[model samples]
Target: MTTLAPASAKPTPSAPTAPTLEWVNKLVSFDTTSRNSNRPMIQAMADELAARGLSPVVLPNPEGTKANLFATIPARDGSVTGGIMLAGHTDVVPVDGQDWASEPFSPEIREGKLYGRGTTDMKAFSGAVLGVLPEFLSRPLLEPLHLAWTYDEEVGCHGAVALVRELDAWGIRPRLCFVGEPTSMRAVSAHKSSQLYRVTVSGLAAHSSMTPAGVNAIEYAARSIAFIRSLADDYRISGPFDESFVVPYTTANVGVVSGGAAVNTVAEKCEFEFEFRTIPCDDPKSFISRIEDQIAILRAEMQLENAAADICMTPLGAVPGLSPQGTRAALELAQALTGNDAEETVVYATEAGIFQRAGIDAVVCGPGSMEQGHTANEYIELTQIAACEEFLHNLAVHLSTTERNEQR
Candidate 1:
């Protein structure tokens, strides 16, 4: 976790006007993982916004561990009627255990592609937004433009919650939002929601020879895991979604599990983490409730033999799913800007759901392939960047058209 000091000055006149490539390089240099503080990156972005004459508000977590940066470029009319929000996360996933060809923090360009830890999983989009700031500012925007960069999106959609709260506190609601997640420049209208849970089972431990005298926590955990798997099967069968997504339905799986000490002694404690990605029509809490009911029955059976037997379940995190609400204006605008007639839905989750739930229409569209994200030697193709730049250019034109139409 290296923290670079924020630059005090604006980009030099000779510097490239577009912020894309250069900003991506700088952002990749910082290791802003969810576990590590993203303050430095937030500070750097705030400085950049300040240089553009826009004052950014830094909303930090209660502990000041991470922060969200928000800035608004007000319309010339001084009316706060409606605006468009550009949202991206500052934090990236951990690369600690992942193997890499080059330094994870250091970015490299090969075969007309940029390779780094956050090259696609979202820092690239953030860079793209910053890179186009000059263009955005140059235009006489009829409506405000809101820039929102949040943290801790990798671990769970936690940081965006703080940002949403801040927006509520300020009473600043945008009419539309774009979450620039990696979509290969296609417009994504819907995505699944993620619900994570940790289950803990506790039992009495004794010598293996005294099996009847001690309750086996691991065995109980195994039973509970089996039930969870069964529920996953049900989700797979009953869940509804568009067939465009890879899985085409809800999915659940166990991610991590830990328990036991010695081979000779009965295991005393067992804990496991599981997650489910559900369609918008599915209730995230239903999965937890079903599991809890099963666990209650299991606990009762265990308690009959040993009063010390216990089981606990807790929600680790939750990100609501975004469904296509009728026809999304943002999606239509994105498609028009990109000159694409077809649109698709993704199985991967993004902050779009949060924005949409807050009454802001949202769509996911950006450069880079999702396959490259979180992989060794991750990269976004140069062509993708070109397409994104064109898209932005077209978006500016569309805004101009809208303003002209309104004037008429």
Candidate 2:
């Protein structure tokens, strides 16, 4: 009689046996949400780079709670200039309201998918880079291979903006930068720009029963938002369109709004956060000018009721778009490595735009999809990880054999 092993003794089909999954698990274990401190996670990655005989630089934020990481695997000739960069953001979006089948921070494998926050919205890409980094180090490289990871991308590209400034100061610029932002291993040469702002409307608070006695801040704010919607509708029906994007025209939305102390009182203050995502060719200033023009009209009307009434606008974040005209080298390289010849443009904004504006050629080519990102039970398919690994190894081989571009 054959002795049968129990079900519990059976091997887990979804266990993290793959090299890329191992790194993914290690990274996804940390909760580096946009609002939380990313120091611990950055330190762990820094330690890994040090262990491999690399001098990884960690630049901390003003509060020192968050950080950005930059490291390089120099070429055989010990040159650290004019090479390729593999980059990704460190922070994940908030999982506050989402109901997850698995714990967001504790990565789990099921059905050949690794489920966790940042798994698709880009820890997997970061993991893939780290997993293949040692291989790049072992090989004799013709040009340096650099790694860049930033904090607070989910909030905005603040970390990347600061990092690029620091890189500028150091005069450490890469010839091409591959920003890993979940394109399912395809290359995205261009992406839309993002501009977010906050508005605060102040008014006199009084009992709801007294109509017009107190300036209704919420009422005036509604008018401003209505104008913003009208602007969005105009864009939707207008001629200034780029058919390449999934959402061809520019988009405007009011994401967050908070006001009104109670149902029985007139709101004394109303605050709202709004954003505009424009195509690379679109002039964001025109959009802003129109919105401001409408807001000014409302502000004047609000003050008509009470001269003390006011509206204040502040810039929250700005991420410039990646224009296709400047990324010839990066496009050619990503195409060579992935064999993906499609002309791709993503509707989502990325740090690639920031890097591109900073005089570095950038392209988005990474594992997984945005469909799985920022949602409950977020997961990245095992196949995507394997393909990304293959791409990275191939990139290493190509870099090892190719000569550095002197034009950069």
Candidate 3:
């Protein structure tokens, strides 16, 4: 991992302006929510980079609806090896049901805070990176600087799988990566793993009058839900605990469930979505396996009631947890950039885990607070944005050959 000196002085007149709320405002206007296509926003940023003599690689998803962008500021020697990566996701969560004081997509400034959908959850960091692109390009750095933008992070980190695969295939391993997830400009060293699953129950349908002839899908679904709650209780009382997190133990919950079409007729189908968060020492797949065992039991019982009864569990998404035990260099670098003496852990998951799993030492350090993300009228403080600009400046200086030389 690379270590940066204190941030340098403000840029010269020839350099681009420091990243500001104006850039974030433009990004929020695009409405690149995970449920919709993000190509428009991707193209817009790609075009901006293209105009500046930098070529960005666009890796589209299988449907061509979304994409990930990877671009590099070549080293002074024109080598693309061993640099730092500044990464973020382009998509944000939807604003369908949240109550908002104003339009969620339209960025607004109130009392020095920029209010918008992705302001804090993170287009602010992206904006800060964009603000300094010209200056980064103008300098002759010792190592390359890469900007990596992925999509569908709000949808269980789906886009990052392909993005990391592409980066790994590129054969030019970066020394480290900085994931700009909101940490109020503080460095985050760890977060819990997140896993989601959808369970579907199928059963025989019949009139309410003929009770035995029909299988009540909802009834069995409730049984499964009860078992899930028991698992949660077990974790709560168990010995596995990491004092760093707000919730030190693992947690499970069924977020969405649906079944019966009518009140009278016997339900023929039921479906429920559930998720779990696990500490770094715990394997999420272990919980999934237990749930599968419970599913088998229900399947057996349902089969006795109705031969046609069946149950299926499908994985929705998963993002690995990041642990700080082996990340001393990355942690030190993050602490230096943020000027925070103590490292912290967060409950909310970020792309840092994915990068860390892929063998890139990653740390989360960006502007704003997680409290503002994924909420109506989300915002980032102007001061936080200013701090990110300073961090970027230090990053630029850190990547320059003028710093003490040490092979990565």
Candidate of highest TM-score: 3
lDDT (10s digit) by residue, model 1, range 1-408: 211122113222322225677898899899987889999989998999999988899988989989999998777676454677889988888777777888988998777777898888888778877888887788777788889999888878888888888888889998778888999878899899988889999998999999898888999999999999999888677766557677877788998999998999999999999988987677777878888899999999899989989988888888888888754778876776676756788888899998888888899998788899878788777667666666666655555443243210
Clashes of each: 1, 0, 0
Q: Which prediction has more favorable TM-score, 1 or 3?
A: 3
How many backbone clashes are present in model 3? 0
- Per-candidate Cα lDDT values, in order, are 0.81, 0.87, 0.86
**Local accuracy of candidate 2 as per-residue lDDT tens digits, 270-379:** 98999999998898999999988888888898889899999978899999998899638887778767766766999999999999988899999998999999999999
> What lDDT does model 2 reach?
0.87
Comparison by TM-score, 1 against 2, better one: 2
In the order shown, the candidates' Cα RMSDs to the true structure are 6.8, 8.0, 2.6
TM agreement with the true structure for every prediction: 0.92, 0.93, 0.95
Ranking by lDDT: 2, 3, 1
The TM-score that candidate 2 achieves is 0.93
Say which prediction, candidate 2 or candidate 3, comes out ahead on lDDT. Answer: 2
Candidate 1 residue spans exceeding 4 A from truth: 1-18, 238-241, 402-408
